[model samples]
Target chain A: MAELVKVVVDAMGGDLAPVEPVKAAVEAVKERKDILVILTGQEEVIHSELKKYQDYPTDRIQVVNATEVIETAEPPVFAIRKKKDSSIVVGLKMVKEQKADAFVSSGSTGAVLVGGQVLVGRSKGVERPPLAPLIPTAKGVSLLIDCGANVDARPSHLVQFAKMGSIYMEHVVGIKNPRVAIVNNGAEEEKGNALVKETFPLLKEAEGINFIGSIEARDIPAGYADVIVCEAFVGNVILKLYEGVSSELIHKIKDGMMSTLKSKIGALLVKPALKQTLKSFDATEYGGAPLLGLKGLVVKTHGSAKAIEIKHAIFQCVQFKQQRINEKIAEKIQPAQFPAPDKE
Target chain B: MAELVKVVVDAMGGDLAPVEPVKAAVEAVKERKDILVILTGQEEVIHSELKKYQDYPTDRIQVVNATEVIETAEPPVFAIRKKKDSSIVVGLKMVKEQKADAFVSSGSTGAVLVGGQVLVGRSKGVERPPLAPLIPTAKGVSLLIDCGANVDARPSHLVQFAKMGSIYMEHVVGIKNPRVAIVNNGAEEEKGNALVKETFPLLKEAEGINFIGSIEARDIPAGYADVIVCEAFVGNVILKLYEGVSSELIHKIKDGMMSTLKSKIGALLVKPALKQTLKSFDATEYGGAPLLGLKGLVVKTHGSAKAIEIKHAIFQCVQFKQQRINEKIAEKIQPAQFPAPDKE
Candidate 1:
């Protein structure tokens, strides 16, 4: 029998709270029999939400009592330090203790980032772990590393991002020797801010990855590279802008379609096809960004994540565990003298 | 009547070169009489293209002979140094020598930035000159400062961008107060990179500008601020990603619309409304980015700028001059001992 991947989820995190997270856990266990979910939150709240689901298996899903909830606005480091029994902290501790294979959260990004590093810990030789998300592109999806963490990254940090992004895309996403490119203002080797200029040559010489040279931001949507490497500031801007532009475009398109009766009828006719096409560009369908280089997997989803997104994030951990991605990452990074986590 | 705004057009710059530049100059003179354009390029080629336009006022337009062209791939500093007879250099020289009120080019961005700082000179007290362009947003347009120039900008540089961008938006775009916001991953004052963290407090205390707090990229398109400030790296990424996402969405929309006869008919019916709505989002309709803080105006249009964009860029100088923007800029900048050019 295949080994069941036990995933710990922060049930009280995100805007939707235990409702979405708890419901998603039930759905996740139902959809995949080879997975077990540990929902961390106030047991009654989680149980109440789970009771709404009639057919989900009760055995595969369990709730761990966590009395505190971390709000989105709270300072991450301080919140994580003070709220020991918070869902986010409890969930991460489970992973740290090797009781859970992966930890998933739609909580405060700052809290998740800080808690993951501080509690769950870093894999050996990893310097400044980054959050890598799959962004939709015309061809398929590309991983944007350091999306919201490590804003002030060095050239060496970006090289690690590139290597980690390549590893994630290859094993989990199934792209072979993924094409890696550093984000810059222009495609030329010498054109970029100091970080990119320093990192470009290093990316070209880095082994085990296909360095495709610099990619202009304008070329990112065309899926020019499988792995897009950048400091967190650039990556965050791109990710947020991508969401903003997509929403604005969609809103504009709908407004245009509803302006007249003729176009309204046209909108009706084109609705299905347009929806299908836009579905391919939806980031939520692809799960959340994994804060790579951590000892145990820590995935951070949107704070507004719903049941489906949370469900997908839970399933993403299964594949991550089955593929033994952390081992691959440990190999990519240079050996450091830090104590390694005990193997299962 | 109104003081004639003497504008220099780089007739041999951009992909369309002498043809589009010459044609736009003719169109500008015909459309507005209070403007004189001095075209710089290989004179014979510009003249040949100019000859194609009939019934244009000949007296207001003049051509200067320049024998060289700066290709897009050439190193900017070297090109500015070696290609003194190039159109970019000649046009900039015209602005520097006070023969022209402004210099407009759809050439190599690097050469224009380098040439603008070296030839046109910076305003007194300006730390670094920034390229500010008005980007189309949901409500209206917002100025994006430091798009490509000053990539590794200091906190003081961003403060200047905010000040200059606010001035441009108020006078040229004609918005009052022109709320300025620094682009960041999060909207909080403390949530930013090292550069933004240092710039945030300075922006809050900056004089002569309306300072808003940090703006996330997602909020930028909603026209949350009239002036969006950031270092060139972040600005360029936002601008390019905006283009890339818009184009991809458009391409996908067209593909969806053409997938079947029903949607195709729908596409035909919705074409007019869609086209008009999309046109509003076009960046070229807003004209080129002005390399602000220069003693004389230096505007760098897209390399792919067409005749209409060129005409618009030339006419933009008219409003800039008529409004006495440079004098306002000079006053805003800290006083220096450099001799001010005599205002005609």
Candidate 2:
């Protein structure tokens, strides 16, 4: 019917590996006729996994032989350089060479980040590609940019993050004129470290985006802003601690519910509604973190991602391609559009 | 009775100023005959609030007049210097003059931090004083040091923090040979930004502490380490985000439990057991954050603290005095005991 969006899936990556990846590719193809998936990994392993699925369009899915796999423990840059035939590297190269419209991986986060940059490369005028993930918040969800990509980012880098994040939230996440805010210890503009202080005024003066002021971490889960901007170090801490605190509390509540016979019966009554509410907050349901500003779309899902998450990540790439997020990012981050802040 | 540990309560501080602080002081003196409290604020306000409570030991609680009040919005350094007659300044000055063994406040965090360092002063060889708060964890509580003070910290400063945090945790929290870990994005030694990278090696080689390498933010809530060390910016994010995520999830759970009639009945049944279980994670139940390395103890309660939390903070000072936490810190952080790392 329409032009197919070709997405390369890393079959040998993540904890579940070929099983989950292959299953997800099949599920994706079954649901959507306007996409094709190229599963990259060891030929035999992928073929055997594919055999378990029947009655799928044989022509839509293809297997590309990749002899090696990049272990999570290996150094990312070295792994990307050495493992040319690995699924992560091969899939990224396919995107680089324009063979695929996008690439999806649940591999070593470090490797995916590096390969996404070194292979697919940054778009012209994009200073650095950032890994922007959609974290669930009380209102809905907000895009947290630069979560693990550039730990030591400069003021200009943060400025670009705000711009790119706004574009992403507006287009893919479909939030209109997404409010962008820089992460700070306090709500005041004068309350951040050197980078945030420098970037605050620039964000206020930046063009073509809805720039809100500084947001404290306490207001983050309340969803005060649609896009949360910070250096990778701060973003990583926020992301991980968000997961850590929520899971711990959930565990404690469950334990409390089962401590007594009355509460145990109560737990059964509230279980379905509670599960439905929490499901809205699940990160995996939102798919992968996209390494934005890349020449081609590249998404990195969790290393522990299951088949459902992989399927969502694949579907996510379709929207990214359809919405032309990269072109919008390129236009917004153009050097001519963003002037450097005056030196103090 | 043992020698009285005189504590100055800032009756002009916090959201519930003279009311809560005065009540807490009266409560503290009634609970412990070995402790005395000095309420510093407007004399009339302090006296009137105290008059509401009859039959409390009159001699144990005294009101010292402070004419000025420091608002939370005022710049910390300027307010501490100009507002000499403010309750915060007067109380800290009393501790400096040895008229009080400890100073407790539910006032502005910034003014308290600045006043603690400037008025109460640092101990010998203490490069910087850090704000260390005990955060609730899955197992129990862990001390998160430098949560708001020393935002732009150096490697040597963090090393001192680790040492100071270890001393406080082992002595005050009663955790013997407490495990100390620096916050990092990853678990590996080579996996941090400039600050964390430089501090990691120094922490490893430092003596008089049990060093447990790098800990990611995800492991923090699981009580992976007894003393969690980080510069203020990262630590602040972790602390605030920990609170943010937990409160939001708890709110969501309550809403979910009341969404339907069946669930509403179930919520009532689970209410008591859940409340008890969640109380263990309430931070105010533990007490205030102590500004370590000071000549006299200074504890900062939350700005929103009620009478109960203020009482707990006062009781916490009694333990600090009894355990000789300052003396232990003075011994542990001596420059001779902590050799500087070799310059790269």
Candidate 3:
């Protein structure tokens, strides 16, 4: 067997907490012999959950005691600093000390982001570590970078996003020469806010990436680009609005189907095919968002994540380790690759 | 009949050009005896299309010749300045001269915005005129202000947006003490970009408006706020992404319904009820985006608008005139209603 990829799972994080994370860790180990999980949380709670599972390799999943929990409402930087034995902080520290290859958490997004940066640290020469999530599009999934990581981002930050996003899509998502585009109000080159207008030309001149021009939000769901780049503010709105509109639309459609007896019968006939079709667009199936450019892989799943998403997030870390995404990011984001820093 | 509300129809605009605009003007005059339309375009083309509709009241619809046309690709400021005899310019001039109560167009968005500001002009103390469109929501429609008008907006500008948006929603849409919220990444007051962070306190303190705190994009489609306020860049993304996702999902559902023979039969049964249910959520049914704070109303319909949308936009002007929305805005946005200007 190949060398095992050690991934630290935050068992006390997210809405489902120890039960779902422990379940997922057990399932992941049973499915893949090339990976092991360090389940971090309260020792007794994790052990109690683990008892429900049987016939798993005893040594593959280990429980690491963590006495503290970082609530989602806590200030991220303060929590990371104060809650030293918290599951999120402990997991990240393990990665920082080189005891684990990756850290996966569905805990407080802010805490995870701070811990990922302050604990695991940024890869050398990487200016900002972005959270890039694979959002489902009509053609396939497209990577939306900087969704909630950095707001008020400058032109230089966006250019780096394009570069890093291209690397992630090409290696992990397996898209060859992924087309990168900046989100703008209009398709025209001159049409954007101040930041987008400044970044458009830089993206066009950037090296080692397939740089497509500006993409309007109307073209996003049509899968017009492989990697969508923007500041965290616009990117967050796009991500959440996509969720809002889809759920609202689905609810409306179901209401329509149930309004009449004829359509009610039709609903039964159409339910299976529609469900299968929509399954391809389910975001959880794609796993967690990776805080790219970190020294060690750090994945942040939804706070409300279930067992399947946690399992997928763990599996995702395995691929990130196997493909050596960090090394590639470090090589691509070297100081020599970028222009001189902008003067304030 | 009541005093006639004269509206200038831009006959030489949009994808459908004189055809749809002329038909809509004739239809408008037929449906409402208290309105007159001044059709501005190349005299021959306007007359030619007008000749096709013989049953309309001749005196209620008059053609005013405009020799030039402004294409959508032209730079807005330059086109508004140089295109002296363009239909957009002539129609806007008519509103400036008080020859019409409103000007409605399916032409270039840029030209309409520039012309609305330069020719029709802003009301006293109105810092920036925002383009406010009523987007369909789960409950009803909500006004999304500054959708494409202002970028890199300041805190003062957003405060004005809140004031103007609240006025428009209350007077036009009939929403009383409408809940106003700034678009933010999170629900917390402290959670926002620089612009939103600065504007949040000002909005809460601003008088003459119901100020709710920050709203995430996820809550927008659920009708969480009656007036959704943001800078143009974020607002544009939300508006366009809403369009993109809904269209794509509708397309996917249709594809799924035809994937199997059983579903094809089921689709036929579900078609009528689904269509009826979806129509309420149709954006075009809500009419055009009004360039608020202008001396005379200017409504911009979609470039690809058909007769129904054109008719709705025209009727929307009637309501604006009847409700005196512009007068109400001027009163609400007086200098006394705002704080002192920020130092540069």
The Cα local distance difference test for each model comes to 0.89, 0.90, 0.90
- Candidate 2 ranges beyond 4 A from true positions: A335-344, B335-344
Candidate 3, residue B46: CA error in Å? 2.1
Per DockQ, the best of the predicted structures is: 3
lDDT string, candidate 2, B175-267, tens digits: 999999999889988888889999898899888999999888999999999999999988899889988998999999988998899888889
On the 0 to 100 scale, the lDDT of residue A339 in model 2 is 60
Sort all candidates by DockQ, best to worst.
Answer: 3, 2, 1
- After TM-score superposition, the amount by which residue A205's alpha carbon in candidate 3 deviates from its true location, in angstroms, is 1.5
Model 2 lDDT per residue over A1-344, tens place? 66899999999999999899999999999999988999999999999999999999879999999999999999999999999989999999999999999999999999999999999998987888889889999999999998965689988888888898998888888999999999998987778887888889889988888998999999999999999999998889888898898888888999999999999998988888898888877888888899998999999999889889889989888888888888888878867465656656
Report the lDDT tens digits of candidate 3 across residue range B175-276: 999999999999987789999999999898888889889888989999999999999999899989989999988988998889998888899999888998
- Give the C-alpha miss distance for residue B123 in model 1, angstroms: 1.9
Lowest-scoring 10 consecutive residues by lDDT in candidate 1 chain B? B334-343
User: What residue pairs are clashing in model 3?
Assistant: none
Worst 10 residues of 3 chain B by lDDT: B334-343
